[model samples]
Target chain A: AQSVAQPEDQVNVAEGNPLTVKCTYSVSGNPYLFWYVQYPNRGLQFLLKYITGDNLVKGSYGFEAEFNKSQTSFHLKKPSALVSDSALYFCAVRDRTNQAGTALIFGKGTTLSVSS
Target chain B: GAGVSQSPSNKVTEKGKDVELRCDPISGHTALYWYRQRLGQGLEFLIYFQGNSAPDKSGLPSDRFSAERTGESVSTLTIQRTQQEDSAVYLCASSLLLAGGRDTQYFGPGTRLTVL
Candidate 1:
């Protein structure tokens, strides 16, 4: 079985400060990790994905995530937080072992609050 | 280009009643997916459709839940005998298939379903 875990329920950060939303996963064989953001009353937006990539993957909205295989973690990071960046973050993983008829398994999500 | 779109932005239904949700994927997208988001929780995979392949029903929670896609365009999810537990935001997403399964899914605004 494939699964994703987001340990933090919420993360608070000041504007212009670096922010990290941690995510870890368990899957059979190699994993394909993804990050998504959702604002209030809106659908989710894809941030980035790690699929047989370099350890570091850059994504939309000045966001990036590092895929750490040894740690089985893919943590989303932003160099500087913006108040507008406050939203719900989700981490998802697709099991490469099952190439067909498989959907992404998502984490419980983490709320990010960036204050001015 | 227009992104994925879902109908009935908000729906309120009574328990034991039947309800149907619709999704329109992006033009030329070969893959479509449906997900459910409960309050303060992560997105749950519901169903997936890719090209002409048999749809993946593995994610559907129960027999009461069923979905169908017409060709590679529109999809409808029907819930028979809806329950309060079925009250959640139903989201639809579409993705262009890429080699090595590196597709990025674009989501719709979602239909907020509330079962009374």
Candidate 2:
């Protein structure tokens, strides 16, 4: 079975500071990892994904994630935090072997709070 | 529509009542998915449909939950005798076919379902 873990329940960072939201996963085969963000009353928005490529992947809204195979982690990062960036972050994974219709297993989510 | 769209943006119903939520996937999208988000939690995959293949209902929580897709465009999720636990935001997403494991999903605003 595929699963994802987000160790932090909440992450607080000052404006302009670097922000990081950690995520780890377990899968039977090569994993397709994804990062999504959700604001209140809205559905999730895709941030980035790591299919197969360089360890570093850039995504929308100036966000990026690093896929560390050895650590089984895909951590979301932003060079500078903004108050508007505060939202709930989720990490998801699906077995690469599964077809496009396979469902993604999501982490418990980490609330990101960026304060000015 | 420019993006995936869900109907009945806000629904409040008494317990044991049945409710139905609808989703309109992006035009030409061959894959659609349904997910549930409880308050303060991440997404939970509910069902997936791809092209003309049978829909995957493995992620559905119970038999009371059912969904149907018309070809590849619109989908409807129905919950019978809904319980308080069923209260959550139901999200819909769509993506292109998965040939290289790089399909990006676009999400809808989601329908907030409240069971009293």
Candidate 3:
């Protein structure tokens, strides 16, 4: 079984300050992790994905995620949070061990509020 | 190039009625997927088509849910005997299938379904 957990229901951060949204996962084998953002009235947009290699993967809108094997965590981070960054964030995972008939499983989602 | 798109941006229907949601994947992309987004829950994988062949429909909630694609271009997801619980936002996504693993799924604005 594969699952993702987003610990926070909402994360409040001050604008121009660093921000982090937590995520953890449970999977049978190595995981293909991804981060996506959803704005109001819009569908999810891919931010970044961690397939292999570097632990830190950079993505669109100055977003990045670090894959920690030991902790089984892939947290989305931004150097300086912008007011526009306020949106819903989701963490998803897929078992890389099996290539066929696998769909990405996502967490409940975290609402990020960047105060100006 | 246009990204994945979905028809019927918003639909309101009475219970027991049938509804159809459409998706237009990006040109040259061979993979298309459908997901459901509940009020608080994150996106749930519903089904996916790999070049007109769906290898996985396990995520679909019930038999009332069925989907089909035409030559990897457009897809239609139909729900019969719609129930109040079926009210949700139907999201469509597409990804390049060259490597499958390396490509990210790009999502559309989605169709907001309201069951009355």
Q: Which has the higher DockQ value, candidate number 1 or candidate number 2?
A: 2
Instruction: List ranges where model 2 is wrong by over 4 Å.
Output: none
Q: Fraction of true contacts kept, per model?
A: 0.51, 0.70, 0.56
lDDT of 3 by residue, B2-38 (tens): 8888999999999999999999999988888899999
The alpha-carbon deviation from the true structure for residue A48 of candidate 1, after best TM-score superposition, in angstroms, is 0.7
Model 3 per-residue lDDT tens digits across residues A29-75: 99889999999999999999999999999999999999999999999
Candidate 2 docking quality: incorrect, acceptable, medium or high: medium
lDDT tens digits by residue: candidate 2, B8-35 = 9999999999999999999999999999
Quantify all predictions' global Cα lDDT against the true fold: 0.92, 0.92, 0.92
Clashing pairs in 3: none
Candidate 2: residue B79 Cα off by (Å) = 0.6
DockQ for each model: 0.63, 0.73, 0.62
The candidate 3 chain B region of ten consecutive residues with least summed lDDT is B95-104
Clash count in backbone of candidate 1:
0
lDDT against true structure, model 3 = 0.92
